[model samples]
Target chain A: MVSRGRPRDMQVDERVLRIAAALMLERGYAGLSIDEVAEQAGAAKTTLYRRWPTKDHLAVAVVARLQADDEIADTGDIRADLVNYLEKIAAGLNRMRAAGHRQGPSAGTVGELVAAAARHEDIGRLTREQYAERNALALALIERARVRGELRADLDAEALFDQMAGALYYRVMITGAPVDRAYAERLVSSALEGNLTCH
Target chain B: MVSRGRPRDMQVDERVLRIAAALMLERGYAGLSIDEVAEQAGAAKTTLYRRWPTKDHLAVAVVARLQADDEIADTGDIRADLVNYLEKIAAGLNRMRAAGHRQGPSAGTVGELVAAAARHEDIGRLTREQYAERNALALALIERARVRGELRADLDAEALFDQMAGALYYRVMITGAPVDRAYAERLVSSALEGNLTCH
Candidate 1:
């Protein structure tokens, strides 16, 4: 519940997060440690503890940064805007999939993150809130399009958004399939247009 | 690559799986152990290992049995059929969500199973294949409807199926939302009719 704002020493936080991110991406979740990160970032253990408190918390912060506030564009063309937003999400998933890497189909790091959330109740709640926050932005975008007559008035926006986003997650985490921009386009098309033949 | 079929002792396999499922559901995945299940089921350790190979394999068998053979019903109505299938999937997810007896928002056992698949290459491949098998059934059903002119001939079948199923998973795993029959109906409607207004 504490505010994750910038500390008095802003540069220290940035340096620590950058180093932490690099460590996680290069060596995987098990390889990430505060002591090692401190040694590399030239920051004291106390500062790291004061900020992150635990390894899982630190990992959450690192991922938060990776998500880089992808500004959603509402160019009135809902389809194009949705595609762009989904592409950003695909890019993030691809980055995680590439992290710690794998010869297997599974995205190991993404699984770790999901497990981390399950392991720690705090992490689970935090991640859920983060998802809800992101989902809210998307829902609002859909609502705007509906108001402007770009989409169906009776559309189940929540279900629509969930389907689009869920497909990407399912592919990355379960199927071990690729989630690139091309896949995002395909997802957008399938979700926006009905699969049923017009009666 | 071994066939998960019957051995010389059919009853032994069923008994072991039943106990394992109970242990997993009552005590959770962490509490379900080979030694304990072996002792309780009065089966030799070698027998269990030969059949399951690993705890993950046993767990997979338990889930497979729980899923049963949900006979897909196609009464010349694709929407009703898809809803029935999605509801079955949702029921499985809800059962798993209730497993480990955790009242927390996260489905801990489901998360563990996913991570287990990620950690072990064999498990990952096995689960992927199982999912593929299930997906194939759904795809064939869709193709039948398409042939009958019920659905669009050029519909992105894979994407449509993925979106509907993925949304259920995303809700259960990530958002911790309830995925009941009503939700399945909503998903089917959204996916079939889509969000785009009629031209």
Candidate 2:
């Protein structure tokens, strides 16, 4: 009948993640150590380990916190709403692209997190679940647009979203290209305005 | 005018890579060791080191070979050509999806190679260059389509290609979904056919 965890426990969780995030931003995935985080957060190593069994777990938590602001907006105008959502995603990717003091077009911490997911089965499943949840929201927004006659009745909503989001990721991970508001706008336009010449 | 290297040297390179590829496909990234490769290849350790310098280098080389078959084919029909090229890319991704004896929707060796590129500056640069070259070829195809009026005169060629390829990579790395010819067709259709209602 009571709360799951004491308010005191919640405070400790916040403080530890804050410290861990700082270390990771300053150094990187390699520089993040549970020992250092525990020492800095003034929390016992066992408490941190109990909550996050591995560095990858903690790193994923940090990224989740960073991406907490990526809420999709549906303004009836699908193009405007899509640009806004994609911009939020770009902002998040840019933040991670610079993590670990990396410069240039390197994927930086993002790449390492991806590898971490591959290295651990649990992490992989957890990340895929999170992405699916996020994608479902976007798809629903697209569906609403379709119902309102803003989009074609037979639109491939899944492919539509994947193309936009995937382009951002492709640039960051593969091309080392810059992803920004301009790129987001371009992606939305290309996606919405079919490439085939109109009859 | 002289050859860059003798035929024997080329043969050794091929033999070593073939063996290395087998080990990587069987054991994944962690299991691919230069020492083991050299031992199995019956080549000197120094020779392998001189050529690849690190395990990341060797792994990258192995993937490049695996992807050698992904040559872009432009048969003049932009729609058909795009679907064909995307199918080739999807096939490559599917192969990597199952590397290291992995099951289910895991990214498998593909994720590890991405991390490997991020971990080393040289590898990152090399891989980016390779992607740029391949991207240029795709872009050229799109340009030809535009020139021939197959696509909109004002189409965002870069964005178009990025969306299609990005969707494939996104499914493999982010969503852990199957990327096959069927999905490739869906992506191409969604990309070419405007999503807007007939006003």
Candidate 3:
């Protein structure tokens, strides 16, 4: 039956993604080659192409797998939850920053992925959709906190989340700064505590 | 004398950048060619290469020029000043979003430039320095506000600034959300007013 290959297909997909991620992390974006991946994976070139279509699609899949490992926890303490979530994000970003044998804070493969998305309309749409799905979980977390009176009823959840996530990205992509658990704590503190002098 | 050619050289740089920017914005990053820019600007290829060295160098120069046009104003009121500066940044991002005949929320040339910076170490260093210099002005504004008691003494100025600027960038590069004057206002309000419920 056609459905008989389902389990084998998923195994192959996992193996292929693992190999591709290893190559991308070691060699960077330009260094990645579809033919080389096919050779290394001992898979048919047609099979690889049929599954991924292009190197961009393969790399994106690799990173998407990395992101899926980061699971959010709602521990009821909004500050702790936010800090934990941001730390997960920072960890992912730090891994990307170190990818491709990057020596400094040059954004590494992450910047290339951003450009890849722009170069391909479908990749752009696909990535945006993935981000939207991921963001909704965090947004829902914030919404829960607000509904429980842990946060201000009128607080801007989207802005709050953006500020925290954006700071991690800005540091990695723009300022070449480090994003870590310490920085995540600082961001959460700043976001939770208003900057203005208390009346 | 070398001094005699200085003014003429400046003129040539301006013309070349203007033409190159037009090409990049109209036809996207791939559409831009150093030879085409040289031809359109009526400058010798050698002169262009001597100054820019590569297409990445020229494109970075073009963006640097655009960023230079956005000057930070210290209007005593940090809220108003921050909002105004962020509005300028949002405007620049919106322009980049619309560049190269992009049809939707794709990052367009901005993502390419980010990749360009990552690909070239020299460009990465140069752009980071430029961003640092620009960020210093904003930091100073936040510091002034802190010193004057407009902000909390223990406030995280760097985090605050990163959050605001990072939100704009995150929206452009990741979320495909619109960043405009209205969104800038919302970002500022969120960063300034903490999200925690009042005791």
Candidate 4:
């Protein structure tokens, strides 16, 4: 019986995360509750706790699901590859922006998540680890491109990555600007091609 | 007597802001209060209220003063100018980072100020305007360099500015990384020369 019920756990997780994500989007971070999610998902409170441990953890899981683990590509053309990678990041930011908080020029859910990470040590560690892993992948992509002479040999790879990616986050959080494909293209172009005057 | 007291009012404004900034940096944003600052500075609550209108407004003023109205220098060398601008930004971030959130890797007052901006429309507008003004100056500096053939003619000025400045903000707000003089140099290098390999 236990063997037969193994897949159902996965099903429950899927349902809970789906319902939780929806609740968060509809009402912002303040509206999402584990009890509500459990009731809505038709799962017991124990089942939810066994997986997420805390609401922050559940929020992390929801975001993790939204994050792209498959977007880092090795298309050989570093410019195109960087643009493609940034487009995925921009799409994710746009989705977060769309999730409610529709009234003001605020990055609602994303702001709350940052606050949440600050509040809990474990949650902060886990979320930071996730970003680190993603950055590692991006860095590896850059490294490969460099090896093939597609990028500058002495390039400060970390700073390069930070500028391209940071611009997207800055627009989303600080300026309340929309991070679209066009914006992504502009960012990649500005970053890949130097802004200095040629000799 | 009141006509003679105009300069005294300026002194009170300076005192109140100084004490408020200290309190905010020492106790974080939640611990900062108009009443406490007024009392500490031996001023009346009515006086503070007449000046700032709200705590958020006062906080905005404190930050405005701390921000470098003196950082936008045009030395004709775009690379060096940008680096100097970014270094000033980093120094401010480092100060905020040191404002006693040593317990955790959180952006402490900076994050709270951002949330406060979101919570109040007036604060958000005022803060955004301050940034806009600073950005205009920086953009002008970049434009001058471009016109004088110190920078690329076809460059995306806004994107270039965003990439350089946004990286500093991104590190402070999201990545919990230290933005320093060295980091500023790296950012300028990456943005100016770009990451693309020479053809």
Candidate 5:
């Protein structure tokens, strides 16, 4: 038996999402709680609970909101598009890290959440679903490049995606190296051209 | 004035390292305490404290011992050597994760230690020193390949090293991918030849 309460309002959901994003950036997923999220959003606990029951669900919604707002550049050039995408990623990571460090959570908190998700089947599925939705635009750009003969048709798109983005995130999380615009450009350009150039 | 006591035997130092490694693999750096380590190794607390004053120093010693005992393969082929190296790293991470999950700490504990090292200057220096010692063998192998003209002369050995090893660890820690033998080979071959091959 479903109890019918007040009808859901879109504005309240958006506000909740915004609050979740801020808290996630500030305190990390591990440190965040639904009660705090509700209080920060100025919404009742029951209202927030109605929308997303679990912390993972709230995180998925917050990440989805951020991804939706992000603009994917389509300059009709594979190299430029990839460079732009990577630069945005690096910048976003840097911002998250800065914000996290100031707020008690480290920037690597997102990666840690993802790592934890891997161990739980339900959480892992939700995490992947969110990631795929976010990456759809980038995947489309890569596919378009392949069709235009800018990228190697023989290469698997999934593998390429993993190698490029996965490698960058790896460096950021493990080595704590700065991933800037220049580094992103080098990675993309090298991936497109074999290192053994016959100049 | 520093208190002078009987000089500790080197064999006892070796035993402490072994016990520390096992403890770290089980309990992680955070869960490992000096008293516990000493008790586990059957060494006196004074002996442990005399050699290493802090848990960080003791942790560094454990890492150093692991690095010293690690055997890197050089098969006269850059691809094979890289694959071998990555396989070893994957194996170590898997073993650590499995043991850690079973006994003491979660999988994310190692990453937390590495992240802490990034923030603390002294710890950062120690972390870099440990990596340098481990990377020496890898760099030597790459240097040999470059001299043999097997790899492009223009390729930056240090950058390549980071990309190769960094990508694997990144995938494991961030993307939650299985770093099996086949995955290691794929990364090595692609990284060596470049990500794209234009026919």
Candidate 6:
């Protein structure tokens, strides 16, 4: 497939990604078809194929767009930064629940896509890269905090990221809970307060 | 349905649970059929259905049994207890990965069952109850630690539980990580140390 040549504006790429994200969220990974994406984006199939060799490529692009849209806070304090991070998590869960309940094509799609990626090597690799990117951001925030003496110097940043994000995602996907702001605050605070050690 | 006489010992029930768990891990939730379960266990369909009305019921039973078998160490130190808890998590994940790779008759069945449960009230309720039971165990562990002065007295037990369990589940279910003992220890230690406001 030959490229129809790059679009005049970056907005075209952004629009395509937005459309892909919405479709994935609604129909799930297995349900998403290239024809659907092309029609939804009002782009040629050849154009999409030129940009993304496979569905995994398309998914990676969409997830990258979503991450780009997510604002990473840097308030100089680890606790405050974490609070902001958790709030974003709570909001994301709420969005997911709302979407799922609306009975649209998008309900259960993200989880389905993630699940599909779990079994497919190429898709799994792309998905892990997305996770690592998000994780790296969290690590950066934590490292900055540690340097500022706001967090324990010896703390494992990757583990902290895993626990906080892991907890939020598990509740949303497995336990099927709201994962509200209050819950996020509690997670951040409890992590800070030392659940395993006496303060 | 007519009442069949009960078995002499509860060993039969234990055997059923073990078989179901193995089937679930190997087949996925969707792959589990009443016929297959009976075939695998050499038990009558009538007996299996009499105990579990649906696959969801069977699954909940299996998970419940696993939960029962999981022993959380109460060694009087939260860190040691957490290490023990994480070790169990790692072992569980290792087992799951091994079973998931086998391409059994029920592959991708668990995800389907879980997805279906999202739409059905009774199944969802049962699944939630199972989740709550597990969550309660984690909460009890944290509460006991707090009472013993091992954890911060002011920490929110529920949130901490979510963070710890949620992170591990996310890694296992979504991110496809090992979630080994070292990972667990780091999580527990970071949350405990990072969350505290040091005296």
Q: What are the Cα lDDT values of the candidates?
A: 0.85, 0.90, 0.90, 0.81, 0.67, 0.67
lDDT of 4 by residue, B26-95 (tens): 8766778999999999998998999888887898788888884557888888888988989998888766
Output per-candidate TM-scores for chain A, rounded to 2 decimals. 0.91, 0.95, 0.95, 0.90, 0.79, 0.78
Q: Using DockQ as the measure, which candidate wins? A: 3
What clash pairs does model 2 have? none
Candidate 3 local lDDT, B135-164, one digit each (tens):
999999999999999999999889999999
Please compute DockQ, using alpha carbons, for every candidate against the native two-chain complex: 0.74, 0.84, 0.86, 0.59, 0.28, 0.41
Please provide, for model 6 over A116-159, each residue's C-alpha lDDT reduced to its tens digit, 9 standing for 90 to 100.
45445566666676767777788898888877777777777777
User: Candidate 2's residue-wise lDDT over B21-113, tens digit each?
Assistant: 999989888889999999999999999999999998999999988887788888899988999999999988877778778889888888888
lDDT per residue, candidate 1, A45-129, as tens digits? 9999998888988988899889967778889999999999999998887777667654546867777777777767888898899
DockQ (0 to 1) for model 5: 0.28
If you assessed candidate 4 against the hidden native complex, which CAPRI class would it receive? medium
lDDT of 2 by residue, A65-90 (tens): 77777899888999999999999999
Local lDDT at B111 for model 4: 69
Interface RMSD of 2: 0.7
State the displacement of the C-alpha of residue A79, model 3, in Å, after optimal TM-score superposition. 0.7
Q: What iRMS does model 4 reach? A: 1.5
CA-based DockQ, model 4: 0.59
Name the Cα RMSD for model 4.
3.0
* Poorly placed runs, candidate 1 (over 4 Å): A1-6, A9-11, A44-54, B1-6, B46-54
Q: Which consecutive 10 residues in model 6 chain A have the weakest lDDT in total?
A: A100-109
